[model samples]
Target: MKFAIFGVGGTGGVIGGYLANAGNDVTFLARGAHLKAMQEKGLTIHTNHRGDIHIEPCKAVSADDYHETPDVLFICVKYYSLEAAIELTRRIAGPDTLVIPILNVFGTGAVMQEKLPDKTVLDGCIYVFAKRSGPGVIEQPQEILRVFYGFRPGQDSRLAEKAAELEKIMRAADIHAHFTDDIQRDALTKFSFVSPMGAACLYFGVTSEAFQENKEVRETFIGLVKEVEALGHAMGVTFDRDLVATDLRLMDAFAPGLTTSMQRDVAAGGPSEFSGLVSRIVTLGKKYHVPTPLYKKIDDWCKAHGLA
Candidate 1:
């Protein structure tokens, strides 16, 4: 199947590189040094489990250079670039195209579905420790490359069939892709980890290792998770698993010195998903009348420090 990736950063580059190297028709829409590098040097993936891969003679085009629609489109940009990403997808995606935004933020499927009403937008979130170490060079430090996605239960259409096809394609490339109707619950469960950890990590200017080393940091992280979990419960999302324990397990499993994308962006003074990951929780809490003192404290710090 034909695939087009909107943003070839950590998430997009890995998936696109894997698919393209597996001999699939994949085009990457990217910009800057990364695009140039992919055009000239090919997209290189330095991975842990499956070893290294180099997709030479790859297909990569800037937004200005791409115009063809594909069987599937992956929205892999940071949450801050959702507007521009959505507009670009609108231009290239057809009605039958399956668009999956495997971003870090929660509620991305709803946002994309609302914006691109004519297209099929699947809710998705990834579990991986990946980053762009250099231009066109993505490094997956861990083997956690799982893609969770699907339509809500009983949302009629061909999405279930399409999702199964997409899952096969992803798994064929050695990527773990799971389809589920309870995407909201899964996304919120993921939010309980990413958003809260990101907020606390960015606020303290630390990484995952910090949570293991410092008592105060661990407490703050756990508090943030509980706040988000409370908000999710208030919103009628049932999370039977021990959310905090899961987060701690993942946190401890993360590589030493591991930091979230938001923390990295803040450190670099670059654009991030501050509003989506940090602010959205507070907004949801208010909407559901769930007090989020911990999130509120982190939000206050972000606002005061100009991190937001």
Candidate 2:
């Protein structure tokens, strides 16, 4: 499959490098220092699970010049950057191209559908954590990587079949992909879990280490999770009520030094994704008449701390 990944920062780099290494025709749409780095030295994937792996000579080009129409396109930019990302995706669209947004923003699929009516648009929710450890180097947490996606509402079976094909392609690349019957619910459920985790940890100074030892902070974490859960329910999205417990279990499996990427951004004095993560939660709360005072408080703290 010919795959093009836009916004190859962390998540995109990990998946794109892995797929390209597996011999899929992969082209990364990149810009600035990252593109220059990948052109000079191919992307590297370093994993504690798989050891140091390098994908030298992986294909990369600036989005403006990537004219090859891809079978699969992964839009992995931050929600705040969605406008530019979609414009770039538009440049490579063919009638049969499938554009799958890996970002969790609720309305992005609709936006893509509006922009590319002829192309198949889908939504994906990924449960892997990765970061650009350095230029052209993607560092992944030592945990299972899961990609779940499906067609949008009222879409045809062709989209599902195409998603399954992409899933097979992913498995061929030694990556895991799960096809879900209800992708919107899957996306919202994930956002319900992630938005709060990123907000509380990034805003309230709750490091992963503290998330382990601090009882009150952990309970607060659960509170924010439940808050999002309630808001999701109000919005007619079904998420596991036991998600808190599941998150607790998942936490144990993560590296002790692991932190939310948003938290990492805060520490690095970079822009944090509070709008898509937390601010969107606030928007949903208002739309559904759900009160998210705790989330709001934490979000305000994030703003004060220069994290928002």
Query: TM-score winner among the candidates?
Result: 1
The superposed Cα distance between candidate 2 and the true structure at residue 225, in angstroms, equals 1.0
Regions of candidate 2 where Cα sits further than 4 Å from its true position: none
The most accurate candidate by lDDT is 1
Residue-by-residue lDDT tens digits, candidate 1, 29-144 = 99999999999999999987788899989899998789898888899999988988899888988978888898999988788888888888888888878889999899988888
Backbone clashes in model 2: 0
lDDT of 2 by residue, 4-68 (tens): 99988777987898898888899998888888889999998778788877888878999888889
Listed per candidate, the RMSD to the true structure in angstroms reads 1.3, 1.8
Q: Which stretches of candidate 1 lie over 4 Å from their true place?
A: none
- The per-model lDDT (C-alpha) reads 0.87, 0.78
lDDT of 1: 0.87
Clashes in candidate 1: how many? 0
